[model samples]
Target: MATDHQGPATMLDVAAHAGVSRATVSRVFTAPESVAAATLERVLKAVEDLSYSPNAAARSLRSGRSNTVALLVGDISQPFHSQLAKSVAHVAEDRGYSLLLCDLDHSMDRLQRLLTVLPLQGVDGIMLATGDAIETPGIRAAIDAAEAKGTRVLLGSAQPDSSMALTVSPPFEEIGYLATKHLLAQERWPVALLSGFKGSVVSTLLRAGYLRACLEAGHSEKETMVLDAGFNSTSAQRETAKLLDGAAMPRGIVAANIPIALGAISALADRSLSVPDMVALVACEEVQLAEQLRPGLTTAGTDIGVQGEAMALALIDAIEGQAATARALVPHLTVRESSALS
Candidate 1:
């Protein structure tokens, strides 16, 4: 018996094994409908036997388009990102486009890697949800490179440079403004804002909006209250306890997000402080956990599901070569017993 030697297979190998031309093999992978059934079957069998995968770049070069989109988010575990993923996936599936998820975790280095790999992997467009400012040079270069290639890039949540294509994010500023204004309207003049990370874009906007409302209401700069809780429930809880223990606690609290709101609620409960009696509370995001709590939370936000849907729709439009425009989705305030005074 003679020893057999195998070498790495190529498109030529598949074509030879299938008894077809290299063009036929390429057609079978790129435009299967153009090839006959018998030829297609033979090419597929050869592909499997040789363990040959069509190079996506070559295929895109031939076909002129790739049916895939990339979605980059800050935190995959967060409810808001999870919801957005679901919505974007549904929309992509309906349009016969595939979605590639990339979680940047707010790391510019990670985002840079994604930019390098995404277009090479044949992504037709990109939807970025930075959740915070992305100022790194590498990440900026990647985004610039993708745009230069005519790859549609739609930014969500965080506003990118005006030169780059971006979609509008949820009205985070309005969320803070309305929540604080609502509290002030209810005679909660001294309102304390428990915000997320100091560097977060949403947090900065929300804090600014809160300050604007306070200033408009004739509240002095000295009386304006704010705390940067650093994006953790435990920290918010601890800060809430400390604030309450201070000489003069605010009558109301506006938490930037759901986790912080939950923490604030826990802190209040630990001290046996009744909501809306000792201190009223409102949050930026509405989570089911809030509703299940006693005196259900008064939130100036809508469902994450809605935000996800809007993001998906905008992404699809960008991918389809539609005009890049900002679309702001305002969250409505849902008044509940948590912020109501009896």
Candidate 2:
């Protein structure tokens, strides 16, 4: 629906138009104080266009009882992680809570610096979306200390000590298995798997999933190769170019992220080989470019926003002294022309 053309829009209506959760709309109107400044701006604009106003007084009263949740992200450029953050923002908004985003410098040491934010009274909880840094005991302990001081702590992905904090994420392994299987089903053999950064929890989980699919399909180890592409377009491109220079080309490929998938496509183009005709491809995360490609990319996608909202709610529940701890989201496959057989 168009932004400005709505009749007596409801909170849910505002969220639908904004591509966020209904609770987010409520948070915008009722708990503007608790909502993230960025989310507040977006929701306010949506409210104006929809010609709807929230019960500001009632919301304000509710906002008094709630505080904002903070989410720390190491890489906002990664499509999958960015999608998850978008979802978290909506969920936080819906619950009449604001979100604080801390863009880290991608160093474990920086996490220590971010810990200083936890002591602030306005920070109700802290969510760690840090990639490999979750493995660092210092980081984990610092987050735990925040929790000990009455701020709830949650994790978007796995950590070295999961029991120390609540964890929520999609079935990552299933996502990888599904993507790899899709490529294999296209009758493409010797499928190459472009795994993400070395030692990344997501990379390990996804690589295992891809291996499961290949082995189940009777493909041998030599038939598939795994590379540590480091989860960026430039790194992926460089790594894939080296693979392209090898003796034999892969007939199919499973990319663990959008950058790797795009890198693979670019490398193939440099060699004058056509996608899907010479090599079928699948991406683990769905992004707009997937649909915009010359022969659109097939991807394994999940309702990350919904999952993020759920995690937020779970954190809220945990803060309220309830027993909710963990939840897993399942991914759905989206088929497009890129992985289709000629």
Provide the global lDDT of candidate 1 against the true structure. 0.76
Write down the lDDT that model 2 would get: 0.73
Candidate 1 structure quality by residue, lDDT tens digits, 117-200: 466445777888766776567667778877776566777775535456466578788889999999999888689999988668
* Alpha carbon lDDT at 271, candidate 1: 89
- Number of the predicted model whose lDDT against the real structure is largest: 1
Residue-level lDDT for 72 in candidate 1: 89
Candidate 1 wrong stretches, greater than 4 Å:
1-63, 324-328
- Model 2 scores worst on lDDT over the 10 consecutive residues at 56-65
Predictions in order: lDDT:
0.76, 0.73
Give the per-residue Cα lDDT of candidate 2 at 30: 36
**Which has the greatest TM-score?**
1
